[model samples]
Target: MSEKKNEGNSVSRRSFLRNGALAAAGFMIVPRHVLGRGFVAPSDRLRVAAVGVGGKGYGDITSFAEGRADIAFLCDVDKRRAAKAITTFPKAKFYTDYREMFEKERKNFDAVSVSTPDHQHAVAAMAAMQLGKHVYVQKPLTHDIYEARKLTEAAKKYKVVTQMGNQGASGDGVRQLMEWYNAGLIGDVHTVYVWTDRPVWPQGVAWPQTNATIPAELNWDLWLGTAPKKNFVDNLVPFNWRGWWDYGTGALGDMGCHLIEPPFRVLGLGYPSSVEASVGSVYVGEFNRGYFPESCPPSSHVTMKFPVKGGKEVTMHWMDGGIQPERPEELGPNEMMGDGGNGVIFVGTKGKMMCGTYGINPRLLPTSRNAEVNVPQTIARVPEGHYLQWVNAAIAGYNSKEAKSLSSPFDIAGPLTESILMGNLAIRSYDYREAKIDGKGYNYPGRYIKLLWDGPNMKITNFDPANQFVKRTYREGWSLGV
Candidate 1:
């Protein structure tokens, strides 16, 4: 797309509505609520343009299609990865660059589904929202705290429907957890432990010393997107990118959204007031440490404190890379603690409750109480699931009741993602180093310090250097259009 095509068209549908263009046409648009729920005409189905249409992106568009959306456009940097989606959506137009698709096919689609790398999520979603297209972006929402906050504000400013791809937010398990908490089955939650066994890919290692040949079908430069320009490395495409800070947010970003959603909702959590972390180290030689700052650590334990009602605070612990909290004494040793691989535990004043990933298999401590505990279900469930919910909400139009009630809309997911990415900020700061005054070695001042957060302003009150991670400068030719 040319600069003119990219920079032009700043006016959005909301802007047109505000200027009374639709009113001048003498045709009033009725609200979806008045049309009755689930009553979309055959021609009124949501027309979706998908970015990164491969792997998880393929699954995302497929789910949207199953939700009664029309898959109209597909974009990806790697044709090999996108081939399946292309075959499935035989008539859908395909493009390698999302900007090209957005500029050329802007009017052909009503919504955009973004399943790109974490680093690109904010830019792509912001562009779509700028054009007044509803967006469903893959989670941790964005790669940085500033992006999360900006996207959240853009959703409201553009009057667009938005949902983060943390499907657990739509699951019945979370609602049950909320109902139980509201019923006082578990008193005010004071602590939470969310652990995941992730980074099945390599991490805590050095970057490739030698550049590899880039694949012919893959657009390596486009794949880099907002990330820094670098030589294409083998085994870095498709999935392993999750371990790198440049393109991914590590294990915490991979699983934190799913594992953290349950407690975040049940406890009504928001931005964390403070954050700190400790990371596990790997040894290369007998004495040498394998400390690749570019890659996420092999294991990390992050602690974040959030203010709750009555001026009390909730201490939340996030563990990844096979690290887990101590087992609770209320459960049998043989019994599983969160599906054996990933889980969340909430400790309340009166008792404790736990659930596996996606908030599945929620049970009170002493699992036997699950059979006896009876709490009236107050929260509604998402029977159509997450993807379809977004599809239907987008079809329902912006600011409609459906849009207002989405499980993980940016209004909620933004703060949740911001808090989750806060853990990452602390992790990256753990490696902060500066040359000592004597100039012989380095001193790590940011290490072991609890970052005092000014959430509303998006700053670290105590640590200035650590604020660098809050936002990143994109490569040339890319911008969030803040």
Candidate 2:
């Protein structure tokens, strides 16, 4: 495919400064004031280097480009997946290994956009921040709680603007939900129910016993990055990685950020005080329960309790794998509950409110109430949307008002991610087992227990074994570099 140019917008002079001969000449340039803020000379645009520039990554960079960002570099382990982006951004330099890209092109770009799998999010985003570049990372921020904490801290230490890829954080729906909650319309939300019909991919399945041939265009080792070394398997590349614990965080990790974020924002939630879970199991033979510790359960219902100020506690319920809470009575029998596939419900002392994923279509219960009530919009709306929010923030400099006001910066994203991953920890611990004394079968001790959490310490006070999931040891060679 031929590279297509944007209509009415020519490539900026900054592109020439960064990608043209001037950059090769090692010219040390001054700051962005030469053209002044009003004129927006091509040289003044934010230069971006995107890692994992394919799939969702490609979409991310495309948004940045559309936001007037200069896509200066593209890196992905699979050329097959990155083909479109390679053609689309022909002016951008390409690389297969991000480490090499960072080392060689660090000075060429002003910010980094990371859209890799959950496992690699922290490493790639951390590397960008370490180089003093603002970053936009996809959600659920990191694979583990520890990585989220580290990335959150790094953003402050590096003094770089940051935003997570959960675009809903910047949507008007959440702000509306927030305004209503603050107005006491819902009257002190005591509980929240967030559910999703996800795992649209397989889960609770055994790992492939046979290794398949790696794709010609892929660098298998590089794609494996921080994950444990494993033989290439069929269909694992572009998507199915979600089923396995090694690559994805199952349905909860996949949808929790979108579903849970609304409640977090509305309630000003932080780490949970305790977590408990119940998971649906897959059966093998007539009498045998299939136990694939390497995979997430086929379905699960997790409950987490958060303690707010004034000694009030709120309970949040997370349901996945097609599970959903009972329809709110206020909803008409014919009415849809949260766009049908995913939704969130906040139950308060006075009434209930709900929204679909990304907090879209938020409505107060008894549907009629939506028409009668009007809450002032106290929060600012992100008309530019999530992608541009990050780009604009980056262009505004680290300490600028825009940077400080990002909808999902690390300070918020990190803890939100950690809180969501906590449910995964409970789920994983639920599957935890030990050998029976008689050696007949394993004894599942982690099941049916509410694991007490020490959020500040990031530990399961009641279950020592579950703590292992809090911070996983990386495969050799890859490190968060904390």
Candidate 3:
């Protein structure tokens, strides 16, 4: 994992000095002079710090490193994880605490990649943006609906470049799907069935016994951050935290953003009218147990109702924990679902379209009848790489043309996030009782409640009391804002 330097192509001293001065003056610094002739002169060579240098964070840093951007710093709560990345960029400074890292090295970096767990994503990303640094945060955007809305607002106020870590957004498949939908290929899509076998890594189950002691190289308290302090349990660290309410968003929050992106974007589906969730009781007594200490909700079924921008309505069903929709007879007998843990199934008036998790080769159903169905040829195709696109965007100061065309912006990401989060809220509401309560205290369960949304205010006109659930109170000194 030795640092790979592009020797013989190093920046000239004069060019480096000029670029440094421009950066110090808060002016843009382009890569043209540093990379010299023959190499593409990107608008700028960003100096980046990676805040979570393990798991997805490691991949993100290397991608930025490959783009010739300087890895100014690497931060992680786990020393072992941090060490693995330090070996890859030996020159980059390392720290176990990102806040401390930001405090000391904030001026040295132009951007940061936040690839931490769902819970810490908003805090880390907002901190970097507040410091006038651009950010690329991982998928699902935030742990709750309120955080997602805040991050979108913060990005606008900061006037900094921003990209969500839904790498699939940069895939050609997604772009093609958009084209198909725009062309009415799916023919007035009215329903969507999105699902995953996630926590495939086991969730909603009994917690495994902790036999191993906390590693000395790990700073467990710093890792917990604003999360209620807890002793280090072996199963909770690394990846299993996805099942706990404290660390992650269970299954729906984990995969919903990616799985539901296509349908939300293509149909222009706005806010939902209502949401309801059903889950097995394993960790807590109620579905929305008002936050817990040990675990998350068990495997659940969540249904959401979206009132489209137009008069039409759309129903989205989310099922996880080995649950799946009935296979469509339209698919050929010989055809089989590709091996993947996650995907989306769009049910339209005419037919269905299936897009896999990474936005891999999406397929249209009615295999026999639609064998000759025309699919528009894409004008632009994104290269088959995710991390590389982010790196190139960072160095160039703007996203590639293809990246801009294929990805979902805040307009789409925001509503999609809100829709998915409603599923979580629905789960909580289900816990209260079978009777659903409106703002006026009217009880109407098992029926769709017409709730009007004011996205700007993050409010529901008819459900004023429920507004508090949309956002959370940040710990003192850790709040994110303009």
Quote each prediction's TM-score. 0.91, 0.91, 0.81
Winner by TM-score between candidate 3 and candidate 1: 1
Q: Which parts of model 3 are misplaced by more than 4 Å?
A: 1-43, 205-213, 282-294, 337-341, 398-411, 430-456, 460-468
True lDDT of residue 95, candidate 2: 93
Which digits, one per residue and each the tens of the lDDT, describe model 1 over residues 380-469?
Answer: 888999999898888777767888889999999999999999998988873345633232222445658888999999999998888888
Clash count list over all predictions: 0, 0, 1
Put down candidate 2 lDDT per residue, 83-119, tens digits, no spaces.
Answer: 9999999999999988777767867788899988888
CA lDDT of each candidate? Answer: 0.86, 0.85, 0.67
Which lDDT value does model 1 have at 340? 93
Candidate 3, position 341, lDDT: 58
Q: Write candidate 3's Cα lDDT for 411-474 as tens digits.
A: 4566678787777655544223434433323232322344455655666566554454566554
- Model 3 worst lDDT run, 10 consecutive residues: 1-10
